[model samples]
Every structure is written in structure tokens, then in C-alpha cells.
Target: MIPHLWNDLEGTFFPESALDYMPEDRLREVQLQRLKAVTALAYDRVPLFRERMTAKGAKPADVRRLEDVRRLPFMVKNDLRDTYPYGLFAVPMSEVVRLHASSGTTGKPIVVGYTAQDMDVWKQAIMRSLYSAGFRRADVVQNMYGYGLFTGGLGLHGGLEGIGATVIPISGGNSERQIMVMKDFGVTAVCSTPSYFIHLIEVAQKMGLDFKRDLKVRRGVFGAEPWTDHMRQYIEAASGIKAYDIYGLSEIIGPGVGNECEYQDGPHIFEDHFLVEIVDPATLEPVPDGQEGELVITTLSKQAMPVIRYRTRDITAIDIRPCRCGRTIRRIRRISRRSDDMFIIRGVNVFPTQIETALLKTEASLPHYQIVLTRKSGLDQMEVRVEVTGDMLRDSVGEMEQLQKRFARSIEQITGLHTTVTLVQPGSIPRSAGKAKRLLDTRNEA
Candidate 1:
């Protein structure tokens, strides 16, 4: 890795990007200034924000310092849905140049809007993200993130172009064509979910294309779903590409809220434009740095739809220690699970990521797996159906039984809940072009 690429924050060529390297005192000064402005904007324009603040007996004027951010009303996912199409918008529809919404599989999709200035800030954030990961203007990036209402595709697309990188706008799916494009176009970088990238690795192997020898891909920017460090290691080892974890949400300006630098230690949050806080999901109280909690963000620079103390629901901690990369921006622990994604099995809180950690540790099976939750005799049960590698599938029946037992033991050790491990043949588990669906809860089924 070229550590010298973006080092020397003082000598940094780009002046607009210098906020990342400012001193902590100066960073907080800027954050406080933006915080006051955004809160006032939301309070004056967005009725929902204003109503919540009023109910709490707090006004924009209550924000005296950074700590006073707690005085502002908190915004949750339901707020966006309750507001529906445009209730939370701080500006009129005419000023909104773009609109993006969540999948809303549960109910009404949470819609978010971006003005022209908002679009510019989003692009700059992405450009900073890519630069932190060692991406330069000469890199060829294949953006496999899905486009349209989903912000992943177009978000990265615009930013990659903003940095002057040649982009292959191949929105998710079409794995075969994706591989072909990488081979023929001399693609050096790729942007997609970590799960989708694993699928690409499998496709390339089937087509007899080696990543290290055949593809010029040296770096991968992966996000859109929670993934573990084990998964990151697996991706890098299997594909021979450095994998960087990026963090963001649809309500918080898409995927450029924070990103991993070349060190891959943690993703640095862009403090100048976004104020981040770790709050206890249950108590809603702030947690000290280095302690895990729900991530809350305030869009400091967003003009069209600025959200205040927006609850992200993703669990992580902030690292205030200086990074080896010399950026003053703080980094967040990689998000592997969300509060809403946790499921209780027989009174034991279990996250899908815990199951993934166990499954990946085995190394005898592929990462393609699903958790099936069922209830029998009024007791919760979990059945892990994981796909075995071709070599493992060819093993004798006794070996397969041993593998299954090993998986069950590993899961029981970590989660303290015994599970039925069902080893399936290769390709039995469904693959996804976007976010991989890892959980299939049938306990509620009649």
C-alpha cells in the first residue's frame, strides 16, 4: 500500500478536503457551527423536527455547545415513514434534485431527498472515502451496486466520476458479464456488497480466471450490509484483493458517512459534515468512546432534508486515538450487527452475524448459508443450512456428519444455543446480487 499517497494533511493538495486533517479543537468548532445551522434549518422548516423539539421544550437556540446536541430531538426510522413521501423535507420539492428510499420490506419505504448542494456534499464525501482507500484518478472502478431508488449504485457512480476515475456502471446481477468486464477492461477497483463480491469470486473461478493473475483488481470497497472481520479476511484471501469496509445508511447521505483507510483499522467518520454519537439502544443515553452502542448521526451539512440525532440502529464504537494515516477524523468499529436484526432464541439474544462468524470459522463450507427459525413444542429452534465446498461434498458420509457436528459445536460454543446443522450441497443456498438474505425466520408461520 502506498502510505504516502494522501499523507501530510497540512500539505494536502485539495483544500476542500482539508477538513479531515484539521486539529480536534478546530474540527469540533466546525462541527458545532454546522450542528447549530442544521438544527435551526430542521426546526424552522421540517415540522416533524420542530414538533419533537417543542415537545421536549427545546429550541434551536438551546444548542449552546456540542454536548447540547442531546437537547435536539431524536429522529428514528419511523419518523421518515410517518412523514411519508416528504413531510421531513426541510426544503420544497422543487429544490430536491434527487430522491432515494429504503427497501421498506416491512412497510412504507423511508424516503430521503437531496438538493443540488446536498448532492455536491455527498459526492465530495464519496471522493474523500475513495481517496482514503487509496483510490486515485487513474483507477478503473466497476460499480456493481444496484441503482435507482436504492442509493448504493448511483451514489458510488457519481463519486467515482467526481474523482475522475473511469467507471463501469454495471449495476448488480449479471455475474458472468461482470467477470468478463473485469477481465477485458483492466478494472483496478470494484464497488459492491461483500456478499456479492464473494459470488463474483466464485464466478471467476468457474470461468478459470484467477484474480491475482488475470484481473487487475487490487482493491474492493464493500458495504450495504453488516459483515464481519472474518468475512473481510476471507474475501481478501480468496480473491487476493484488499477489502475495505464502508459505512452509511439511506437516511444519512447514503454510503459515504465513513470508510476504512489503507490501514484497515476502522472507518473514519467525516466529522466536518456529520456529527456522530454512540448511544445506548435501550436507554437512549450516550455511551463513552470505545464502548459499543447504537450509532446516531446528525447531518451537519445537509440542506434539503437535514435529520437531527438520527438513530442508525447499527451497533459500533468510536476510536478517538490517532490513526497511523494521520487523519484527525475519528473511526468507527466495523458494523457487523444492528439492534433490529437481533433475534431472541429461547431467551438468548442471537445475531445472524454470530452464526456467520461460526460458519466462516469452520472453513469446510462456503459462506452461502441461511438461518431457519422454527417453533415446535413451544420452544424456539434454529437450523443452519450451509453449503459445503465441492471437495467437502465429495467426502464420505461419516466425514459429512463430523463436519455438521463441528459446526453445531462451534455455534453452541459461541451462542450457547444448540442448533441443527444441515450441510447442503454446493449452490443449494440462494445467492443475491444485492444484499444477501441470510435469515429466514419461520417461527411466526402458521
Candidate 2:
């Protein structure tokens, strides 16, 4: 039996050498070919996609080059909502062997399906990402991502198992037990949201457990929310683990679109399976390489649900230069924010990440924070909720008030938007074992 690691070129034969090290010209040619194929598949198999392509007067033949993808209409979350349960599925429901869904906090959950072939591709992608993050078949990985409905849990679990890693599918929550199991099992790697990992550090410390002595963890895979580089540095220092970012969305596949290698640079995308494009969110035109824009993806190999020109709304840029690790596949900068996660406050568009960046720079501020958007009269108001350390809370009330003013000023200077800053005692903010809820918009409410 062949091992599934990417670097084990002698053992793994699934992902051909071409996907990673193919010349740029040939890579483009492969993308062009797959783009046409997926476009045709979506047009033929899914009615929602067919109507969308028809409305744009775009046929599969129109997508002959990498640049021609602009002709296809964009797929958004609402389109899946309109389709309901399995409306956008390319294959019949019977053919779909697996199903996954989004949180649906705003409305009906956006669901996705996978056939046997799709499952194989999904599994391979995850395994490749895990290898990219420096995990080996010998490593014991504690999968702390949520299990059901959410894709992070099962997505990481199957991939870890495929690579022959000792996977502890602990499945999110249970901070104390998480530390205990990680210690007793001698976990060497962990996969979870970056915030949850920080919470673990706090709980472990409160319980008088030290990662440097009590735990064997040395690496982590963090995703499901946009975190800043400061948070990465803090996680690395607190837990003594080399943290890596993994990117994916439920609309396309899940948790396997791209990942950071040992280099800790931008994530190398699995372009052979996913055709990626960066486009202006406002104009919907392709953005030049190295320019920040919204990410758009088309799944070339998926059978049950092939999405063409799906607008991901993620904010990042693509780097086409060959990686130092020798992979020629293009990579995307870590996602800083998403369109759904953005909100307008008094004419200023604010992202939670921007607030996070400001908070990280402010002294006496903990990593825990949230953004709230409320409608005051006819205007939108912004509020930043942050937690401070116990020592900061113990300071004089006047000093604490001064800290709030200074923090608000820093945010304004960074984001060019004034905000109401609210400080809480240590551990006051509710923590999450899954994706952190960073923003709450109530602009439409009375």
C-alpha cells in the first residue's frame, strides 16, 4: 500500500508531479482544459447553473482560456438558499454519498453534496494540505474542529486517517478534557480555530498545566475564521507550536482548498482540483496578480456539486511565483476578511480583522474581542467589545477609562472610523471551540 504524503513521491501516486511542479504555461493549459470541462458539467447537470449561464449568454465553449471565466455568472450563498435542500446538486440525490452544510445562522443552511469520486478528491486534498503543514503519518493529530453540520471536523478527520496519522477526533469543546487528552495521548499536532487554541492555553495555565512540559504538541492547523499575524505569534509563543493557516469553504469543498507549508508563507492552492481566480468584488472583473481582491473558485473534479465561478467573497491576493519549496502551484495570501463578515458603519466599511489588528497593537488588550453594529436613529454605529487582563482591570477606574479612550483612538487611526470601545474583565467574553463569532450586525433591526 502506498503512503498518502505529498513529499513521499515514491509512495504516493495519486497526485501526479505535474499538479505541483508543472511549468506555468502548462499549468494554465491544464486550468483552461478543466475550466471548460466543469463549466460544461454545471451547464448540463444543474438547472440553477444552466439558467445563470444562459442569462449571461455564456456557453461552455466560451470558457476556452483562463481569462474567459469572467463570462460565467457568479454563484452566491443566496442561490443555494433559493434552491433549498439539494436544488443545486449536479447529480441526483441518490448518487450523493455524503452531505455537508454551513451554519445557516442568517437563514437556511447552504448545503453541499459529494459523490464517491468527490469524496476521494476531498480526502486527497485534505491529506495533501496536512502534508503541506509538515504533519507526517507518524504524528498524532487531535482534531478539535466541530463534527456535524460544520465541515472542519470531519474534513480534517478523514484526511488525518488517510495519511495514517493517529487521529483523535475529539470534535471541538471541552477545554479541560482537551488538554488532558492531548497530554495523556501525547498529541503532537492539533487542528482547530486559532481562538480556541488560545482558550486552551488559558485553561491549561489555570489548571497549572504547561505546554512546554505537560504537552507534546508542536504544530497546529487553524481555520474557520480570519485571524491576524499577531494572534499567530501569540499562539506560537504561548503554546510553543508552529501554527499554520488552512483555507476552504463549504460552497466549493471544505478545509482543503489551500494550506501553508513549512515555509509558513501563503497557502499553496490545490489548483489541479480547484480552478481559482481573483476578481474585484465590486466590478466582478479579474484582478491582476499580487493585487488584493475577492477569491472566486470553480470546482473542476467534483461530480455531485460542481460550482462554476462561485464568488467566495474572501479578501486575498494570489502569488504566482514559484515557492521556495519548489511547488509551482500558485498560492493565495491568508484571508483577512470575507464580504459577509464586512459591515458598513456611518459610511465606513469595517472588517472584524481590521479591528483585531488594532486591538492586538493596543497594550493591555487581550486577543478576545467582538464587533457589534447597531442602528442609532438613521445612522449606523460601531462598537468594539474587548477583554482586558486581570491586572489592567485592577487599575484605577480612571486609568481603565483612559485605556478605552486610547484604544478607540488607535482603532480610528487604523480604520479611519470612530468606534465605541467597551472593556470587560478577563474571561468575560464567551469563547468558542468552533469558528469564533466576531461580528453581529443589527442595522436592519428596529
Candidate 3:
């Protein structure tokens, strides 16, 4: 179900090699035209944008080019929260067909309403992502990401259907059932969080299932959590499938925002649908191309709920040049860290994902660990409590000490911060149904 509107503009506004050969000035012109149309819509329809523009003593017409977007006020998550339920909705209730809400970890769930056309746009983006990942009509897609209010499962399902693939909507959990379905139905592809995929591999081994020989899966799209190249190699080695990294958030759209192709260089952003900008987190000014900073997005062609200059705390860089796969759309590097999630440990910025990468490379039997941050004697400290598995226990006391020292040194190398490594029994850390929250900051308690 490709959008008819997209097809109409395919050769004119969006060319196959636009990013590759299109001059920057020409691309900017197209973006400016779209920005003007969206701004006009915001001024005439959405009260939130109208009030925001008015408060700035600016009118929608004042935004005539891409540069003018900087003058427009930035939209933050708090704005959506203040509006609540549907206050920020641009279209009337009658036109809306679906509503999706954020996980609400920060506060109230930010609700977004979508019309039929908006849903089509979402499907098209997801389909584009899947196609970029090498999925085809005959492939059997096993969706392991959770379904429902969370966007992973349903969003990918829509895409698989769009691509004419046999979609097995096996939402997360029930690893045994997932394996059974895969074996019985000959599923060819799978999608889920990287952690869950690792867990499933462990379960498969325990049940005497050979991942490479038994499963028909040829590719796996892993996202919803940050992963490193080392983790990608591990997943590929375990599942006998080419692993691709996908990037998205419910705030803008679902998992189809960007995806890595067979080249596995980086996840290409669907720039024709969504415009991405990398800005200095503190100044909100655009950084030079390829510089790491916060990612800001604007929905260029959305009708139901168009988000403009929405700040995504995720930190990454953008490459506007053509990819090795010959796609002209800009590609975004895997997110290095989220600005909101960065912990200040003794004046150093620490990202939990980096620590996780370090841990995975340690080859320690510890698959589960928790990072607890506390202040003692007016100083900050990080305690990494890791559960020792059978592999680590096979070593003697001296080997265990060496493992601990090695981990501490690795942590220092990656995060540039000293960490206290505590070995614990397996199954000690709390489990989570959704994304795991590994960090516990008790600094306020001090």
C-alpha cells in the first residue's frame, strides 16, 4: 500500500538519486516549499502552533524557507504533555482513525492522533525500511517485538503486509512458541530487540535447538534499544542471520524512521518523509555535517499530526551522501547516547549502552547486570552489579579476580570512569517487560 501522493511526487520532488546528485540548493528549495505548506497548515488549523507562533510575534507566512524554521519555536515533549490526550491534534476528532501514546516514562503519555492517510504514511515508511533491509514478497517475517500501544510490533506488521510478505505477528515473550512457529511455518525473517534475540538464542540452546541449522531465518532487524557493532556480530553468530539495525521512536513515527541495508554501514533515514537535523544540544544550532549532536525531526508530509522541530534527545550524526547500496537518502549512525539518559559521574558523561558493549566483549558469563549510581562522602560512585553465569564459575578464584580487574579496566577505557564490579548470583537483577532500566541513581538520597 504505497501512498498515491508519494508516487505522484516521486520523479518531481523526490528523485531516486536526489541525495546523490541533487544540488544542495535544489534540495533546500524543495524542503522550503514543503516547510511553507506545513507552516501554513499549522497556523490555520492547529491552535498550539498558532499560539506558539503568535507568542513569538511571528506568523506562519514569515517562515518562507528552511532557514525560517529556526525562527519558529521549538516543540518539546512538555508541550504535548500540557496538551494531554488530544490537545495538540491538528485535525478534528472526526478525521482521526487511530491514536498512539508514548511510554510516559518522563510524564503523561504524549498522545498522537492519526488519520487514514497518516496511517498509510506510517506503513509506507516501515515498508521502505523493510525493503531496504532486503525483505521481499516471498519472505516469511516473524515479528518478535511487542505489539499494542508500543509501536514495534504493529508498525512492522503493517510494513511486512505492505511488502507482501507472510507476516507472523508473534509479539514478544513465549520464546518456545516463537521457535515452534518458526520451525513449523518456516519463518524466514525475525524482528525484535537485541536483548530479546540473545535471550531467545539462549533458550534455543537450552532446548537443544540449533539456531543456524534449525531456523529458516535469513535476516533479523534489531532495535528499540541501542546496540553496538560487537553485539551485532554476536547476534549474527548466534542466530545465523544477517542482522540489521533499525532506528525509530513513537513520537515521530515507529521503527521505520531509518534502517541499515545489506552493506551494514549505517541506518539510512527516509529523508523524503521525515527531515532530520543534527543540532548542538545546548544551543539548538545546526552542527557541521557528520558532527555528533542531538537529532531533531520534522514530519514533512504528515497530515494527521505533523511534528515540527521536535527535539529527539538521541545523539547521532547524519551522512547526506549516497550509501553503498545506491540509496540517496541520508543515513544516521547508530545513536551513541541519549542526552536525557547520560549520567554525570564525577563530571564525566557516562552512557549505559557503552558499558553494556564493554560487558558483552568481556566474554564473562554475566549476561545480566545493573548499574547503580550513588553519592557517598560527597562523591559520586557507580556500582556495576553483574550476575555470574556458569562460564565465569568454571574459572578459579584467581581467574575470577582477573575477570573483575579486566572488566574494571574495560569500563575505564570506554567510559573513562572508575566502576565497582560486584559479582552476584544469577537471576538476581530485576527483569523488565519492556526496555530495561539498568541505571539506578540514588544521588538525591545523599
Candidate 4:
């Protein structure tokens, strides 16, 4: 296994990692200063921001303290849709150097731009993320994140190079090639979604390769979707590597918003560059620390597109307590649910992660599963189709029936809703190299 860059005794990753361990008072002061400047930039340059602020009778000058962030109007996904291509950008096209976008449910994609200075800050954030995850210059990292319009690939790619780590820019897919290259190059680290890594583990197993014995990879930085501790435990047990959760969105600044240190308790938000607030998704009121709510963010250093009070809709809580890693930045609970992904069935609210948590409890089932929703008798019905191990598949009918009943019981215990559990073969579920589509709502489909 490759050694991590972190120094346990010194409580620092390296000499340049001072910003992460700065005093809370000092970090807050820097955040406030940057917040004021970013708000002012948006108010002056973006008409949408100006009109929204004016309607609320608030200006950048009104931002006297950090709490004044509430005075600023909230921005949502529609704000980006209404603006289209560049409506929310704070800088001119001449100054903007790059553009990245995520596919929207409707017409136009949610696009975000980055100026040269913005790119530098983004890279610095990614570098911090890598260092915090114990990545070092000596480690060979195979970046499996998709490149191009998506921000995951290039974001980590640039940071890996910036940190002097040798990178194989293998942008997603080609599972056999990915594993072959990993083994040949003696890759020590990987960056990708947890789902993809799990798929890789399965693929390696099928190819007669043991991750713990045949592979040299020791660390994995996974993000771009909400994963659970159960999934983490599965990955660690299956493949001998410490999996770290990373948080970010293209609207704010790609995958550098925050990341977990060696502690892996939760990911620490880069407070100096991005301001985080957990608010009640319904009322839009700020919630106290340790309480779960929607995660909202304000980009303080982004020059191209500085979003103000942008609601991320991710459900998580903040931990303001100091960490053993000595970083002053606060950490957020691992995101397992999204405000928009919840569906109520039989008067019970259900998130796919709840089902995932339940499905992972049994060793007989693989992590691959799908939730199928349909309307029958004007009522919603959920059927979870999960892939079971080959041994379970080859078991006697009586034994298989018992396993199915056990799975249904575990799921009901967690969700309080009974679901039809159908155990399929291992490779029955479609695998995705990017974000896994776990939900299928055919109720609305004709």
C-alpha cells in the first residue's frame, strides 16, 4: 500500500496545509471578507441577483455579518434554468476560461463557467481534498470520473497533477481496461463514484483477481452521489481500501466543496472559499448544527459564477466540533437523501437510500438493486428488484424463498413499508459508470 501524505504527530498534511488548520475566528473572518466581496460582485454584475436582492430590499452593503446571508434571496435550480447559458455569471466572457454543465430534467442543461482565478481556487480546493484523503505525490492515481461537460473528471485530474501525483486520465467505462491498467500501472489510488467502484470490485472478482492480493490500490475518493456507511463498509471489506466521501456540485465549484480527512467521520467543507448553511427545506430557515436539513451553499471565491444562497437540496447536518485532524472547517454528515428524491407511498416517505441501507445488511445480496414504482388501484406500489449472489441464486427454491422473506423483513424494518423483494441474478441489474439510476417511477409513464 502507498503511504499517505498526512503526518499524524504534526497534525498536518504538509506545510502548505495551514489554511485548513487555521483558527475558527480567523477562518470566519476570511469567510466574511470573501462573502462580502462575492455578494457585491453578483449584485453589481448579474441582473438576476440584483433584481432578487432589490425585491428583498437588500444589497451587498447590507451584509454586515455572516448571519446576514439570510437577507439575500435564495437561488434554486430554476434560477439557472431561467438564466440559461450565462445569466448568472459574474465575470465577462473574456475573463471566463472554462465551462461545465450537468443535464437538466427539462430543456437546457445547467451550465457553469470558471474564470482563470476561479479555476486556481478550484484546483487548490481539490488539492486540499486529495491531501486530506491521504493522497501523495508518490501514489499513482487512476481517475475514473467522466470528463468533458461533467466536472468530476477534469476537476480531480487537474488537482492530481497539481499535487504531483502520476495520473492515468482513464475517464470512466471499459471496466476490463480500467482494471487491467490499474493492475499493470500498479495504481495506488482511484477517484470515482462508489457505485462504479463496487461494479469494479465485482468485475475484478469475475476476472479472477483479488483486490486485496492482486491490486495495489490503497485509497478511493468517491462522490457525485449519496452513499451510505453500509456501502462504505462493503467496499472496504470487499476491497482493501479506505473509501472517502467527497462533496461538490458544478454550480458551486465541482467536487472540491469538501472531503473527508483520515478520520472519515464526515467531509469538512472548505469554509474559506465556500460558505455552508443547513436550512429547513420547507421553510428555508437556517437550522441549528447537528440537526438535519437541506444543504445551502454560497461560493465566496468563484469569479465566473458566484451563486448567492444557492439551495443544494441535499439532506445533511453540520458538526462544528473540532476534529482530531485539527482542521477548523466544519464537517457535514454523509448525504444519504435528497429533498427532491423523496416519494411518499402508503403515507410513508421513502428515500432510495433507506432501501439501499436495508438491502446491504445481508451478505447474500450484492449492492446492485433498483426500486420500481407503479400505480395500482390509484395507490403507489414499490417493488425492489435486488441482485443476489450466485450461491443464493443456485440455492433450492425453499431456501431462496426464505432469503427473499428475510430481505423483505429487513427492508420493512428500515422503511416501515413492505416492498415486493425479487431476487435476481448477480449481473441482472444494469451497471453505470457514472451515477447509478436506482429509481424507476413508471407510475407517471403511459
TM of each candidate vs. truth: 0.96, 0.92, 0.91, 0.96
- Each candidate: what lDDT? 0.88, 0.84, 0.79, 0.88
Residue 259 lDDT, candidate 2, scale 0-100: 86
lDDT of 3 by residue, 197-238 (tens): 877777788789999999899888888887778778888887
Question: Which pairs of residues collide in model 3?
Answer: none
Model 2, range 1-446, lDDT digits (tens) per residue? 22233455335454433356667687778788888888888899899889877887878898767878878888887888999889888888889999999988789888899999998899888887888787777799999999997889999998999878999999989899999999999999999988888888888988899888889998998987887787888889888999999989889999998888778888889888888889999988888999999999989889898888888889999986767777777899988788878877777877888888787777623457888888888887888888886535645889889989988998999899988999876667666667777777888876
Q: Count clashes in each candidate, considering only residues at least 3 apart in sequence or on different chains.
A: 0, 0, 0, 0
TM-score of 3: 0.91
Question: In candidate 1, what are the lDDT values of residues 1-446, reduced to their tens digit?
Answer: 12244643344455445667888898899999999999889888988888788899998898889999988878899989888999989898999999999989889998999999999999999988888887777889999999899999999999899878899998999999999999999999999999999888988988988888999999989999999888888889888899998888999999999999889988999999889999999899999989999999999999989988999999999987889887888999899999988999999999999998898777633458899999998889999998876656644888889888989998999999999999887788876789888888999999
- N/CA/C clash count, model 1: 0
**Candidate 4, residues 1-446: lDDT per residue as tens digits?**
11333643344446445678778888889999999999999998999999988898987999999999989999999899889889998888999999999867567899999999998999999998988898888889999999899999999999999888999999999999999999999999999999899989988988999999999999989999998898898899899999999999888899989999999999999998999999999899999989999999999999899998999989999987788877878999989889888888888889998888887776533557899999997888989998876545644888889878888998999999878999877778776789898888898876
Local lDDT at 225 for model 4: 92
Q: Which consecutive 10 residues in model 2 have the weakest lDDT in total?
A: 1-10
Reference-based lDDT, residue 243, model 2:
97
Name the 10 consecutive residues with the lowest summed lDDT in model 4: 1-10
**Model 3 whole-model lDDT (C-alpha atoms):** 0.79
| Stretches of model 4 off by over 4 angstroms after superposition | 1-5, 8-13
Task: State which candidate, 2 or 3, has the greater lDDT.
Answer: 2
